[model samples]
Target: MLEPQDHRLRQREYLLQISRAITAQLDLASLLNLVITYAVEMLAGTSGLIAIYDEEGDDLLRIRASSQLPRDIWPAFAPLLALPLADLPRQGVAVLRDVATDTGLNLRQMIALPLALRQSAVGVIYVFRAALNVDFSANDRQLLQDFANQAAIAVSNARLYQGVLREKQRLDAMIEQSADGALIIDSRWRITTFNKMMEQLTGWTRDEAIGRPCAEVLGIHSDQGVNICLTDCPLQRRPPAENPVAEGRITSRDGREIYI
Candidate 1:
């Protein structure tokens, strides 16, 4: 029998394993596989599963990975694990000592830990044992719960980073497709990004336009005939959402007038 101190040490080791596994990859599939494998090995569970909640349409728990469970069981098990966020416990762990003992239920010796973020349950980490020898103790349940909390934060961050990348790609495509010149200016009025039309119209390449002041690059002049770069520009007067577009005349490097 493992002593209380031994259990604590084992739990610490398991937590470290989980932390290392999560940090090892930004890819969701690799992260899910790591979580399931680590949970089964460290928690002494015969099987492990990770189910991620869909953000759109439904609150279903889509199984990301599993070990040692029948493929058919997933269809039935998904609904049982897909309880609403409000119904789950805020903190602490839950343990079902022997699933086999509960004749009506098809599962045995399991624990469910909510992968929570900002007091919401985003997913579930389930660990199960088919035989009595590898049954989860109260301490094991607590350790697994703590691991789940950390995993949730890691998963959330990964998802957010992925979303940012996708949004960037979409914005880039939109800029390329635009008929008019689309330029992104920084707080200092420097051109951060400009569409292909802007480059072609101004006789400037993307490489030359980036990081240069708009007035210096586009040659916009004020009503007083002063360089706009020397004056407070109107483009910076409003927030991005409020002022996405501006119209002005610019002189090309070749001395041709162009409307932007």
Candidate 2:
């Protein structure tokens, strides 16, 4: 009974809900739940699911909360659902009008949208209604399609954030395990970070070393007794491509010799 323009406005409002959901939470599971809940409510779907494919695309994991189907049914559909349907005749987004008439098994009045990133199909978003009284309209399909696109972006961002966090943890562990004193410097020759060994060797804590200029802190001297911090400082000058390692002798505050 809704007019075309009214449906369009509803869809816009639904998209705004999805956008706010993605931005509100950094946690992947919570964000995904919000998306699925919003999709089901806005599209008048009795049941819905959000599945993410494994890296090999051979397995699908149902991650979001669903309404129509019991949680027990998902594991059985994992294998078939995970396979990429990109080559199907309908492609990118596929819609089934009738649950009873549709040939696909275990799905009824379903809308499947491929989740793509960097031109590669990563997974699919599925929304459906199981009741015989419920029917999907063109407007519903369009709204679900837009919601799927937003879901794809949210999933990609969450994955990237998790990846960065994992890398940071790995780097921190490696730095902690290193035997030699190691320090990281930016292009400006300022100390960005260093390992615990560096702190112990120089009698300086990490808080004191961070953001300080390397030349002023390390006090490097040449063989000729010239202060390397004043001129020809390896830390201050850019390194040659062929010989990138910069080696110099530094005198610590207590007159200890340190090699950088």
Candidate 3:
């Protein structure tokens, strides 16, 4: 058995570790698992569950992650998990009153903490203790609250990252499927994106073209045999408000001169 002071010191160290874990994690699923695992470990609870707010869910709250929660008793816990936000305790901790006596499971004690941000509830974390005699202490509640606050911020950030990633995927798909011979460049005028149409038109594989200078890939030159890309590059002269068109000729990979 550890002294109270030593136990507290260990708890603080564990909390610090969790702080680092949540900050570095961006994947929503992995973050939720981390939250529930840490919550259960910190509280010495038998199981844990994290439910995120979902408007389309039949219960309004969807169980996104669980730790040590038994599959057999999941159906029995539905009513408790589905409790409305208005009915849940807004501050501190409380008993899971929704757990019915007939549920046939030993889990009786619970600490429910709403994952709140800016006074709005984003989700909730539930830690369950199987032993009815062992009650959560005031310190336990406060420690959980502190951990929950960090977890809430992490969850919000992870959601934003996932949303941005999905949007980027959609945009990437649109760019690849576009019919135009599209090529993207960075500030240094290096090729960053070369789509299929560009690959076909320039006779350069995407793998061979990307990261190369656009001027080198296209080899565009005027009819007078002057390299247009090296002198008065059309890309640099394009007006911001109106699109500019400059015709030039390029020598393809097969040594054929193609007009653009």
Candidate 4:
């Protein structure tokens, strides 16, 4: 049995280890695996599961990670995790020993912890003790709770990253399909993106036109043959051309000059 001082030291070290592991990688699968693996090893348990609540609750809680749990039987327990268990009891913990005799879960012991982020519960960690006559102490619960909070942060970060990627993809698709010769530039006039229409009109692939200046790509001229790129840059005038339209000459890749 670990003395009070020894338990405190061990808990402190374990918490630090967990923090390092979770922050080392932001991938959701990798984070979940680290969490479950550490929990089972530290608690001296045989198996474990990390279940994350579905954001919309439209889908059941997802088994983000697991160990030694029968893969085929995991779905049978989904109903149990549909509702998240937020806070521990007043003792700051609970224990269900020999629960298999009553509930037939086949688990020798079960300890549930709330994966909390700030004031909200995001998920739960379940560690199973089999063939070990040990019970989790209050210190153990506190340590595990801290571990679960790290899992929650990893989950939230990965979810936010995924949302940002989706938005970028959607915006790119709209820009590519736009009917006009669409190109985006910063305040400095260097092209940021050149769309499908822009590529076709210029005879330059999107890859080739990006980063080139407007004057370099489209050298405009007035009907009087005034070199607009040098002398009559409408974009530089006080009241920039009422309509951002002007006749310009574009040099294609094959050395053909086309007027627009």
Cα lDDT computed for each candidate against the true fold: 0.70, 0.68, 0.76, 0.72
> Model 2: per-residue lDDT, tens digit, 6-124?
86786777678768877775576666666677787777676677887675555655545554656666664454364456543353223333222343333555566776677865567
CA error at residue 42 for candidate 3, angstroms: 1.5
- Alpha-carbon shift of residue 203 in model 4 (angstroms): 2.6
Q: Taking the tens digit of each residue's C-alpha lDDT, what string does model 4 give over 1-260?
A: 66778867876777677677666755787778878877777777788899887888664577888877666767755545654454323222232332344345556666788777767767788887776468877866776777788788888878788899898788788999899877777687778778998887777787777888877776665556566877766667777768765576656667666677
Per TM-score, what order, best first? 3, 4, 2, 1
Clashing pairs in 1: 99-108, 99-109
Deviation of model 2 at 9, angstroms: 3.5
Estimate candidate 3's alpha-carbon lDDT, on a 0 to 1 scale: 0.76
lDDT of 3 by residue, 89-183 (tens): 55122325435354554566777888988897778888888887999889778877876786688777877787898987887688899998888
Considering lDDT, which of the candidate structures 1 and 2 is the better prediction for this target? 1
Deviation from native of the Cα of residue 90 in model 3, angstroms: 12
**TM-scores of all candidate predictions against the true structure:** 0.63, 0.67, 0.75, 0.68
Give per-candidate clash totals. 2, 0, 0, 0
Name model 2 segments beyond 4 Å from true.
1-6, 13-25, 64-108, 168-174, 186-192, 207-255
> What TM-score would candidate 1 get against the native?
0.63
Model 4, position 237, has a per-residue lDDT of: 76
The candidate, 1 or 4, that scores higher on TM-score is 4
